[model samples]
Target: MWSFVGKKNQQRWLWHAIDHASGKVLAYVLADHTDAALKSLMQLLTPFGIEQFYTDGWGGYARLLDEDQHEVGKHYTQKIERKHLTLRTRIKRLARKTICFSKSEWMHDIVIGLFINRYEFGLPI
Candidate 1:
């Protein structure tokens, strides 16, 4: 799943693939929430051999993922939703209403990338 950042029309999405068993973020893509964007994320996850994708009823998910492998429902996507909540709590830019926001898409992506790299993946920035 993904969340929007920045103002409307100028917003960007932070798409994520979370491992249910480990509760770790697998891959993420920063882009518009489109089929092409989701396709890129799926490509990144291809090496992991993901057999099933549980996501919301997003048209992109339904269109890109195989019907049999796609499970559309809120119950199945709790982990990712919780991850979204964590992101929102930790990243002020992701908050629903906040004056602090990235002025450029470059800064937006870099900030979020650093956070995920250092905090989520435990890599030194």
Candidate 2:
């Protein structure tokens, strides 16, 4: 449950990675959707090994899951997708069509990461 928020006028991208099982966010970075960002995420999760992953049909995820046992499909990722909805509701920053309270793409990613870590994973932060 990690993603970047790119505003229509923003220049930077927000990167985040969340643990699905415990809902803990692992890392957050402000970068483009380049190989470096993907690599950084992989490195952050490298110690965990090839755990089961569930993602939508995002091309970036395809490359990230190349070495891991990743599962991609609408049905397979229903839980995460639902989680995203929950996240959007809980975090006003992610709500659609908000103008006054907009987060920088980088901060949005980091905030989501923190939300996942604290709420989803039950982490005491």
Candidate 3:
């Protein structure tokens, strides 16, 4: 999902991993849309023993992910896409055309992280 900090032009990307069966976000990284950001998410998921990755045809996924284990298509990505929609509904900052935007990257990450921790991880708020 995409959002902005300080200004609409400053695009920030939310990259996350979810359990295929449960639809729970396992880990997430908030950064620009780049391979380094994807790498950070991959590192966080290192202990999960993920055998396959279903992703959109993002160039970073193609470059970094193992070809055999990665499948780039809409078919296998519905759950996560739906999850993103739900996030947009719940978080005003995630909405595309809204005045509710973060003033800084720190605030943006904190709000998103807290939301994910409470809802996705089932942690006490």
Candidate 4:
């Protein structure tokens, strides 16, 4: 998921991964769409012992993930796409044409983190 901080030109990407069966967010990071960012998300998922990865045709995934473990196609990512829709609908700041948006990177990450922690993890904030 992609949103911006201060302006649309300064885009911030939400690098999130969800469980296929449970449809729950596993981990996420707010950063530029770079290999390092994806690497960080992958590291967060390390403890889960991920055996396979379903993803789009992102160059970073191809570079970072092992070929046998990575499957790149839209068909395999339906659950995550649906989750993205839910996120975009619920988070006003994620909307492309929204008046309410994050003015800084710090607040942007925090708000999204809070929402994910509360709703996805069912944690008391």
lDDT of 2: 0.62
For model 3, what is the alpha-carbon lDDT of residue 31?
93
Model 3: lDDT to the true structure: 0.87
Write model 4 residue lDDT over 34-109, tens digit each, in one string. Answer: 9999989999999999899998888898999999999988877888888788888899888765677788889889
Stretches of model 4 off by over 4 angstroms after superposition: none
The clash numbers for all candidates, in the given order, read 0, 1, 0, 0
Candidate 2 lDDT tens digits, 1-125: 33334555553444555666665456655566577877786787777764776656668777657645777776555555666688778877666545524456545656666776787567776
Model 2: CA > 4 A from native: 1-6, 9-31, 97-100, 103-110, 123-125
lDDT of 1: 0.82
Better of 2 and 3 by TM-score: 3
RMSD of each: 1.7, 4.0, 1.4, 1.2
User: Each prediction's TM-score against the native?
Assistant: 0.90, 0.61, 0.92, 0.93
Cα lDDT tens digits for candidate 1, 20-125: 8988999999998788988899899999999988887878887788899999887777777787787788988777656767777888799889988887799999
List per-prediction Cα lDDT, in the order shown.
Answer: 0.82, 0.62, 0.87, 0.88
Better of 1 and 3 by lDDT: 3
